[model samples]
Target: MSLVVTATGTEVGKTVVSALLLARYRQASYWKPVASGACEGSDSETVQRLAPEGTRILEEGYSFDPPVSPHLAARWAGESIEVERLVPKGRESGLVIEGIGGVMVPLRDDGVLFLDLLVQWGQPCLLVASSQLGTLNHTLLSLAALRAQRVPVAGVVLNGPPNRDNREAIERFGEVEVIAELPVLDPLNRSTVTQAASGFDTAGQLAGLLDQSQGECR
Candidate 1:
Protein backbone atom coordinates (compact mmCIF):
# COMPACT_ATOMS: atom_id res chain seq x y z
CA MET A 1 0.00 0.00 0.00
CA SER A 2 2.81 2.37 -0.90
CA LEU A 3 2.82 5.16 -3.48
CA VAL A 4 5.57 6.61 -5.63
CA VAL A 5 5.69 10.39 -6.05
CA THR A 6 6.93 11.50 -9.44
CA ALA A 7 6.58 14.65 -11.50
CA THR A 8 6.68 16.12 -15.00
CA GLY A 9 10.13 17.58 -14.34
CA THR A 10 12.57 18.56 -11.66
CA GLU A 11 11.57 21.10 -9.00
CA VAL A 12 7.91 20.77 -9.89
CA GLY A 13 6.85 20.24 -6.26
CA LYS A 14 7.34 16.51 -5.90
CA THR A 15 8.92 17.03 -2.50
CA VAL A 16 6.08 19.27 -1.36
CA VAL A 17 3.51 16.75 -2.54
CA SER A 18 5.45 14.05 -0.73
CA ALA A 19 5.22 16.09 2.45
CA LEU A 20 1.53 16.59 1.96
CA LEU A 21 0.98 12.87 1.51
CA LEU A 22 3.03 12.19 4.62
CA ALA A 23 0.95 14.71 6.52
CA ARG A 24 -2.25 13.13 5.31
CA TYR A 25 -1.00 9.67 6.17
CA ARG A 26 0.88 10.41 9.35
CA GLN A 27 2.09 6.84 9.82
CA ALA A 28 3.46 6.55 6.30
CA SER A 29 7.25 6.50 5.95
CA TYR A 30 9.04 8.54 3.26
CA TRP A 31 11.83 7.20 1.08
CA LYS A 32 13.74 8.82 -1.75
CA PRO A 33 15.63 5.95 -3.32
CA VAL A 34 17.91 7.85 -5.69
CA ALA A 35 18.98 11.38 -4.85
CA SER A 36 21.18 13.35 -7.26
CA GLY A 37 21.45 16.76 -5.60
CA ALA A 38 22.82 15.82 -2.21
CA CYS A 39 25.20 18.79 -2.21
CA GLU A 40 22.36 21.20 -1.54
CA GLY A 41 19.91 19.25 0.64
CA SER A 42 18.10 15.95 0.23
CA ASP A 43 14.35 15.85 -0.24
CA SER A 44 14.20 13.33 2.61
CA GLU A 45 15.58 16.00 4.97
CA THR A 46 13.07 18.56 3.77
CA VAL A 47 10.24 16.05 4.20
CA GLN A 48 11.48 15.27 7.70
CA ARG A 49 11.33 18.97 8.53
CA LEU A 50 7.90 19.50 7.00
CA ALA A 51 6.16 16.22 7.74
CA PRO A 52 4.39 15.71 11.06
CA GLU A 53 6.61 15.10 14.06
CA GLY A 54 7.49 11.41 14.60
CA THR A 55 7.11 10.61 10.90
CA ARG A 56 9.68 8.08 9.72
CA ILE A 57 11.98 9.30 6.93
CA LEU A 58 13.99 6.40 5.57
CA GLU A 59 17.57 6.63 4.36
CA GLU A 60 18.19 6.96 0.66
CA GLY A 61 19.58 4.13 -1.44
CA TYR A 62 21.96 6.14 -3.59
CA SER A 63 23.09 9.70 -2.94
CA PHE A 64 25.42 11.71 -5.18
CA ASP A 65 26.76 15.22 -4.58
CA PRO A 66 26.30 16.67 -8.06
CA PRO A 67 22.91 18.12 -8.91
CA VAL A 68 22.70 16.52 -12.31
CA SER A 69 21.02 13.58 -13.98
CA PRO A 70 21.27 10.56 -11.72
CA HIS A 71 23.33 8.67 -14.27
CA LEU A 72 25.72 11.57 -14.71
CA ALA A 73 25.88 12.26 -11.02
CA ALA A 74 26.65 8.66 -10.19
CA ARG A 75 29.26 8.57 -12.96
CA TRP A 76 30.89 11.72 -11.60
CA ALA A 77 30.98 10.11 -8.17
CA GLY A 78 32.73 7.02 -9.57
CA GLU A 79 29.69 4.81 -9.12
CA SER A 80 26.93 3.30 -11.20
CA ILE A 81 23.28 3.07 -10.23
CA GLU A 82 21.87 -0.42 -10.24
CA VAL A 83 18.13 -0.29 -10.60
CA GLU A 84 17.69 -3.57 -8.71
CA ARG A 85 19.26 -2.24 -5.51
CA LEU A 86 17.08 0.85 -5.57
CA VAL A 87 13.97 -1.10 -4.64
CA PRO A 88 12.68 -0.73 -1.10
CA LYS A 89 13.75 -3.58 1.14
CA GLY A 90 11.64 -4.03 4.30
CA ARG A 91 9.23 -1.13 3.94
CA GLU A 92 6.52 -2.71 1.87
CA SER A 93 3.52 -0.94 3.37
CA GLY A 94 2.67 2.69 4.13
CA LEU A 95 5.68 4.04 2.24
CA VAL A 96 5.84 7.11 0.02
CA ILE A 97 8.68 6.96 -2.49
CA GLU A 98 9.91 10.19 -4.09
CA GLY A 99 11.50 10.00 -7.50
CA ILE A 100 14.37 12.08 -8.87
CA GLY A 101 13.51 14.52 -11.65
CA GLY A 102 10.78 13.34 -14.07
CA VAL A 103 9.33 9.98 -15.00
CA MET A 104 11.54 9.46 -18.01
CA VAL A 105 14.74 10.45 -16.23
CA PRO A 106 17.64 8.09 -16.82
CA LEU A 107 19.01 5.99 -13.99
CA ARG A 108 22.00 4.66 -15.88
CA ASP A 109 23.96 4.98 -19.11
CA ASP A 110 22.29 1.85 -20.50
CA GLY A 111 19.01 3.80 -20.96
CA VAL A 112 17.20 2.49 -17.88
CA LEU A 113 14.75 5.17 -16.71
CA PHE A 114 12.95 6.17 -13.56
CA LEU A 115 9.83 4.81 -15.22
CA ASP A 116 11.53 1.43 -15.38
CA LEU A 117 12.16 1.54 -11.67
CA LEU A 118 8.52 2.33 -11.05
CA VAL A 119 7.53 -0.68 -13.10
CA GLN A 120 9.89 -2.86 -11.12
CA TRP A 121 8.55 -1.61 -7.80
CA GLY A 122 4.96 -2.37 -8.88
CA GLN A 123 3.47 0.51 -6.91
CA PRO A 124 0.99 3.08 -8.12
CA CYS A 125 2.32 6.59 -8.79
CA LEU A 126 1.05 10.00 -7.74
CA LEU A 127 2.06 12.26 -10.61
CA VAL A 128 2.92 15.78 -9.45
CA ALA A 129 2.46 18.50 -12.06
CA SER A 130 2.65 22.28 -12.25
CA SER A 131 -0.56 24.23 -12.64
CA GLN A 132 1.18 26.57 -15.09
CA LEU A 133 0.97 27.12 -18.82
CA GLY A 134 3.19 24.31 -20.13
CA THR A 135 1.84 21.68 -17.74
CA LEU A 136 -0.65 20.25 -20.19
CA ASN A 137 2.03 18.95 -22.51
CA HIS A 138 4.37 17.81 -19.75
CA THR A 139 1.69 16.14 -17.70
CA LEU A 140 0.09 14.39 -20.64
CA LEU A 141 3.44 13.16 -21.89
CA SER A 142 4.34 11.83 -18.49
CA LEU A 143 1.00 10.08 -18.23
CA ALA A 144 1.40 8.60 -21.70
CA ALA A 145 4.81 7.24 -20.80
CA LEU A 146 3.51 5.69 -17.63
CA ARG A 147 0.53 4.18 -19.42
CA ALA A 148 2.81 2.85 -22.14
CA GLN A 149 4.74 0.99 -19.52
CA ARG A 150 1.50 -0.30 -17.95
CA VAL A 151 2.28 1.40 -14.67
CA PRO A 152 -0.69 2.01 -12.39
CA VAL A 153 -1.19 5.68 -11.54
CA ALA A 154 -2.99 6.58 -8.33
CA GLY A 155 -3.79 10.10 -9.57
CA VAL A 156 -2.33 13.52 -10.34
CA VAL A 157 -1.51 16.24 -7.83
CA LEU A 158 -1.32 19.72 -9.30
CA ASN A 159 1.08 22.09 -7.51
CA GLY A 160 0.99 25.87 -7.80
CA PRO A 161 -1.84 28.35 -8.46
CA PRO A 162 -5.18 26.64 -9.08
CA ASN A 163 -6.32 26.59 -12.67
CA ARG A 164 -9.73 25.13 -13.47
CA ASP A 165 -9.13 24.88 -17.20
CA ASN A 166 -5.84 23.11 -16.79
CA ARG A 167 -7.30 20.75 -14.23
CA GLU A 168 -10.24 19.95 -16.45
CA ALA A 169 -8.05 19.43 -19.46
CA ILE A 170 -5.74 17.12 -17.59
CA GLU A 171 -8.62 15.05 -16.33
CA ARG A 172 -10.42 14.95 -19.67
CA PHE A 173 -7.43 14.26 -21.86
CA GLY A 174 -5.29 12.39 -19.41
CA GLU A 175 -8.30 10.33 -18.24
CA VAL A 176 -7.29 10.50 -14.58
CA GLU A 177 -8.52 12.32 -11.56
CA VAL A 178 -6.83 15.49 -10.29
CA ILE A 179 -6.75 14.18 -6.76
CA ALA A 180 -5.53 17.47 -5.26
CA GLU A 181 -4.42 20.95 -6.25
CA LEU A 182 -1.78 22.44 -3.94
CA PRO A 183 -1.37 26.20 -3.73
CA VAL A 184 2.00 27.85 -3.47
CA LEU A 185 2.90 28.47 0.17
CA ASP A 186 5.04 31.41 1.21
CA PRO A 187 6.83 30.12 4.28
CA LEU A 188 6.40 26.39 3.44
CA ASN A 189 6.68 25.31 7.07
CA ARG A 190 5.12 22.49 9.08
CA SER A 191 2.02 24.41 10.16
CA THR A 192 1.28 25.56 6.61
CA VAL A 193 1.90 22.06 5.30
CA THR A 194 -0.51 20.67 7.88
CA GLN A 195 -3.14 23.21 6.86
CA ALA A 196 -2.70 22.33 3.20
CA ALA A 197 -2.84 18.62 3.96
CA SER A 198 -6.13 19.03 5.81
CA GLY A 199 -7.82 19.75 2.49
CA PHE A 200 -6.11 16.92 0.64
CA ASP A 201 -7.81 13.52 0.41
CA THR A 202 -10.71 14.90 2.36
CA ALA A 203 -13.07 12.42 0.71
CA GLY A 204 -10.57 9.60 1.24
CA GLN A 205 -10.21 8.91 -2.46
CA LEU A 206 -6.42 8.70 -2.24
CA ALA A 207 -6.70 6.60 0.85
CA GLY A 208 -8.87 4.12 -0.97
CA LEU A 209 -6.38 3.96 -3.81
CA LEU A 210 -3.53 3.29 -1.40
CA ASP A 211 -5.63 0.68 0.41
CA GLN A 212 -5.12 2.52 3.68
CA SER A 213 -7.60 1.92 6.44
CA GLN A 214 -10.34 4.49 6.98
CA GLY A 215 -9.49 7.49 9.16
CA GLU A 216 -5.76 6.80 9.27
CA CYS A 217 -4.66 10.44 9.34
CA ARG A 218 -4.87 12.08 12.72
Candidate 2:
Protein backbone atom coordinates (compact mmCIF):
# COMPACT_ATOMS: atom_id res chain seq x y z
CA MET A 1 0.00 0.00 0.00
CA SER A 2 1.54 3.28 -1.16
CA LEU A 3 1.18 6.37 1.00
CA VAL A 4 0.02 9.53 -0.76
CA VAL A 5 1.68 12.75 0.39
CA THR A 6 -0.18 15.98 -0.37
CA ALA A 7 -0.32 19.52 1.02
CA THR A 8 -2.81 22.29 1.70
CA GLY A 9 -1.03 24.30 -0.95
CA THR A 10 2.17 24.46 -2.97
CA GLU A 11 5.52 25.16 -1.29
CA VAL A 12 4.04 23.88 1.93
CA GLY A 13 6.85 21.26 2.28
CA LYS A 14 5.35 18.28 0.47
CA THR A 15 8.71 17.53 -1.14
CA VAL A 16 10.55 17.83 2.16
CA VAL A 17 8.03 15.57 3.88
CA SER A 18 8.29 13.12 1.02
CA ALA A 19 12.07 13.09 1.42
CA LEU A 20 11.70 12.55 5.13
CA LEU A 21 9.36 9.62 4.50
CA LEU A 22 11.68 8.11 1.91
CA ALA A 23 14.61 8.48 4.27
CA ARG A 24 12.67 6.95 7.15
CA TYR A 25 11.24 4.11 5.08
CA ARG A 26 14.28 2.73 3.31
CA GLN A 27 12.22 0.25 1.32
CA ALA A 28 9.85 2.91 -0.06
CA SER A 29 10.45 4.65 -3.41
CA TYR A 30 9.32 8.18 -4.37
CA TRP A 31 7.04 9.19 -7.21
CA LYS A 32 5.44 12.49 -8.28
CA PRO A 33 2.66 11.59 -10.67
CA VAL A 34 2.12 14.94 -12.41
CA ALA A 35 4.89 17.53 -12.35
CA SER A 36 3.99 21.02 -13.68
CA GLY A 37 7.24 22.82 -12.91
CA ALA A 38 9.65 20.83 -15.04
CA CYS A 39 11.27 23.99 -16.39
CA GLU A 40 12.32 25.16 -12.95
CA GLY A 41 13.25 21.75 -11.54
CA SER A 42 11.67 18.43 -10.69
CA ASP A 43 10.47 17.38 -7.26
CA SER A 44 11.57 13.88 -8.23
CA GLU A 45 15.07 15.29 -8.74
CA THR A 46 14.98 17.03 -5.38
CA VAL A 47 13.70 13.89 -3.66
CA GLN A 48 16.34 11.79 -5.39
CA ARG A 49 19.05 14.20 -4.26
CA LEU A 50 17.76 14.48 -0.71
CA ALA A 51 16.71 10.86 -0.23
CA PRO A 52 19.40 8.46 0.87
CA GLU A 53 21.41 6.49 -1.66
CA GLY A 54 19.62 3.61 -3.44
CA THR A 55 16.21 5.35 -3.08
CA ARG A 56 14.23 4.54 -6.19
CA ILE A 57 12.74 7.68 -7.74
CA LEU A 58 10.17 6.67 -10.29
CA GLU A 59 9.43 8.57 -13.53
CA GLU A 60 6.53 11.01 -13.52
CA GLY A 61 3.30 10.17 -15.30
CA TYR A 62 2.96 13.66 -16.74
CA SER A 63 5.64 16.35 -17.02
CA PHE A 64 4.88 19.90 -18.15
CA ASP A 65 7.37 22.76 -18.39
CA PRO A 66 5.14 25.58 -17.14
CA PRO A 67 5.09 26.21 -13.41
CA VAL A 68 1.34 26.65 -13.09
CA SER A 69 -1.87 24.77 -12.41
CA PRO A 70 -1.68 21.27 -13.89
CA HIS A 71 -4.74 21.69 -16.11
CA LEU A 72 -3.52 24.99 -17.50
CA ALA A 73 0.00 23.72 -17.84
CA ALA A 74 -1.25 20.75 -19.82
CA ARG A 75 -3.25 23.06 -22.07
CA TRP A 76 -0.24 25.33 -22.55
CA ALA A 77 1.79 22.30 -23.51
CA GLY A 78 -0.98 21.24 -25.97
CA GLU A 79 -1.91 18.18 -23.97
CA SER A 80 -4.30 16.88 -21.34
CA ILE A 81 -3.81 14.92 -18.14
CA GLU A 82 -5.38 11.49 -18.04
CA VAL A 83 -6.17 10.59 -14.48
CA GLU A 84 -6.09 6.86 -15.15
CA ARG A 85 -2.51 7.00 -16.38
CA LEU A 86 -1.33 8.56 -13.13
CA VAL A 87 -1.52 5.24 -11.29
CA PRO A 88 1.75 3.94 -9.82
CA LYS A 89 3.30 1.21 -11.91
CA GLY A 90 4.77 -2.19 -10.95
CA ARG A 91 5.58 -1.65 -7.29
CA GLU A 92 2.47 -1.13 -5.12
CA SER A 93 3.73 -1.49 -1.58
CA GLY A 94 6.55 0.64 -0.14
CA LEU A 95 5.95 3.68 -2.35
CA VAL A 96 5.41 7.33 -1.48
CA ILE A 97 3.39 9.24 -4.08
CA GLU A 98 3.45 13.03 -3.94
CA GLY A 99 0.59 15.09 -5.29
CA ILE A 100 0.75 18.39 -7.19
CA GLY A 101 -0.60 21.65 -5.74
CA GLY A 102 -3.56 21.45 -3.36
CA VAL A 103 -6.25 18.81 -3.12
CA MET A 104 -8.89 20.91 -4.92
CA VAL A 105 -6.70 22.06 -7.80
CA PRO A 106 -8.09 21.20 -11.19
CA LEU A 107 -6.48 18.30 -13.04
CA ARG A 108 -8.49 18.48 -16.27
CA ASP A 109 -10.75 20.82 -18.21
CA ASP A 110 -13.82 18.72 -17.41
CA GLY A 111 -13.63 19.74 -13.72
CA VAL A 112 -11.77 16.72 -12.38
CA LEU A 113 -9.64 17.69 -9.40
CA PHE A 114 -6.59 16.39 -7.58
CA LEU A 115 -8.94 15.33 -4.83
CA ASP A 116 -10.85 13.28 -7.35
CA LEU A 117 -7.67 11.54 -8.37
CA LEU A 118 -6.90 10.79 -4.73
CA VAL A 119 -10.29 9.19 -4.31
CA GLN A 120 -9.68 7.17 -7.43
CA TRP A 121 -6.35 5.95 -6.12
CA GLY A 122 -8.03 4.92 -2.83
CA GLN A 123 -4.78 4.96 -0.82
CA PRO A 124 -3.95 6.30 2.59
CA CYS A 125 -2.89 9.97 2.61
CA LEU A 126 -0.52 11.96 4.78
CA LEU A 127 -1.52 15.62 4.55
CA VAL A 128 1.34 18.12 4.89
CA ALA A 129 0.35 21.49 6.33
CA SER A 130 1.95 24.60 7.82
CA SER A 131 2.44 25.00 11.54
CA GLN A 132 1.78 28.73 11.60
CA LEU A 133 -1.16 31.07 11.89
CA GLY A 134 -4.28 30.26 9.79
CA THR A 135 -3.36 26.57 9.75
CA LEU A 136 -6.33 25.85 11.94
CA ASN A 137 -8.72 26.72 9.11
CA HIS A 138 -6.72 25.27 6.21
CA THR A 139 -5.88 22.04 7.98
CA LEU A 140 -9.40 21.51 9.25
CA LEU A 141 -10.90 22.26 5.85
CA SER A 142 -8.51 19.87 4.12
CA LEU A 143 -9.27 17.15 6.62
CA ALA A 144 -12.98 17.67 6.13
CA ALA A 145 -12.65 17.44 2.37
CA LEU A 146 -10.60 14.28 2.52
CA ARG A 147 -13.00 12.63 4.92
CA ALA A 148 -15.97 13.69 2.82
CA GLN A 149 -14.50 11.69 -0.04
CA ARG A 150 -13.79 8.74 2.25
CA VAL A 151 -10.06 9.03 1.61
CA PRO A 152 -8.28 7.22 4.40
CA VAL A 153 -5.97 9.69 6.11
CA ALA A 154 -2.85 8.14 7.57
CA GLY A 155 -2.16 11.31 9.57
CA VAL A 156 -0.94 14.89 9.30
CA VAL A 157 2.62 16.24 9.07
CA LEU A 158 3.12 19.84 10.15
CA ASN A 159 6.12 21.57 8.55
CA GLY A 160 7.47 24.94 9.63
CA PRO A 161 8.17 26.59 12.99
CA PRO A 162 6.75 24.59 15.88
CA ASN A 163 3.32 25.70 17.07
CA ARG A 164 1.93 23.64 19.89
CA ASP A 165 -1.47 25.34 19.92
CA ASN A 166 -2.00 24.68 16.23
CA ARG A 167 -0.90 21.08 16.53
CA GLU A 168 -3.27 20.49 19.43
CA ALA A 169 -6.13 22.10 17.58
CA ILE A 170 -5.57 19.95 14.51
CA GLU A 171 -5.26 16.76 16.49
CA ARG A 172 -8.34 17.59 18.54
CA PHE A 173 -10.71 18.89 15.88
CA GLY A 174 -9.35 17.02 12.88
CA GLU A 175 -9.28 13.78 14.87
CA VAL A 176 -5.93 12.67 13.45
CA GLU A 177 -2.50 12.20 14.82
CA VAL A 178 0.28 14.76 14.35
CA ILE A 179 2.54 12.08 13.01
CA ALA A 180 5.53 14.42 12.79
CA GLU A 181 6.43 18.07 13.24
CA LEU A 182 9.30 19.04 10.90
CA PRO A 183 11.04 22.27 11.73
CA VAL A 184 12.72 24.42 9.12
CA LEU A 185 16.30 23.20 8.79
CA ASP A 186 18.95 25.91 8.89
CA PRO A 187 20.72 24.35 5.94
CA LEU A 188 18.34 22.02 4.14
CA ASN A 189 20.46 19.09 2.98
CA ARG A 190 20.56 15.34 2.98
CA SER A 191 22.12 15.29 6.44
CA THR A 192 19.39 17.51 7.89
CA VAL A 193 16.76 15.47 6.10
CA THR A 194 18.19 12.30 7.57
CA GLN A 195 18.24 13.87 11.03
CA ALA A 196 14.64 15.01 10.68
CA ALA A 197 13.61 11.59 9.42
CA SER A 198 15.28 9.90 12.35
CA GLY A 199 12.80 11.73 14.57
CA PHE A 200 9.82 10.73 12.42
CA ASP A 201 7.79 7.53 12.76
CA THR A 202 10.10 6.55 15.60
CA ALA A 203 7.48 4.12 16.93
CA GLY A 204 6.81 2.66 13.48
CA GLN A 205 3.25 3.97 13.56
CA LEU A 206 3.25 4.99 9.90
CA ALA A 207 5.03 1.82 8.84
CA GLY A 208 2.46 -0.18 10.76
CA LEU A 209 -0.38 1.68 9.04
CA LEU A 210 1.05 0.92 5.59
CA ASP A 211 1.31 -2.73 6.51
CA GLN A 212 -2.41 -3.06 7.26
CA SER A 213 -5.49 -2.68 5.11
CA GLN A 214 -6.67 0.92 4.55
CA GLY A 215 -9.33 2.27 6.91
CA GLU A 216 -11.22 5.58 7.12
CA CYS A 217 -10.56 8.18 9.78
CA ARG A 218 -12.99 8.36 12.66
Pick by lDDT: which candidate is best?
Answer: 1
Counted clashes in each candidate structure: 0, 0
Tens-digit per-residue lDDT, 1-218, candidate 1 = 77899999999999999999889977678899999888899898899899998888888999998899998998888888988887675545578889999999998998999999999988899999999999999999999999999999989999999999999999999999999999999899999999898899787777754446874568
- The 0-to-1 C-alpha lDDT of every candidate, in the order given, reads 0.89, 0.87
Q: How well does candidate 2 score on lDDT at residue 7? A: 88
Residue-level lDDT of model 2, residues 1-218, one tens digit each, is 68899889999999999988888877777889999989899999999889898888888999998899999999988898999888866555578999998889999988999999999989889999999998989999999999999999999999999999999999999999998899999799988998888888666778854442322111
Residue-pair clashes, model 2? 0
How many pairs in model 1 have backbone atoms within 3 A of each other, for residues 3 or more apart or on separate chains, i.e. clashes?
A: 0
Worst 10 residues of 1 by lDDT: 208-217
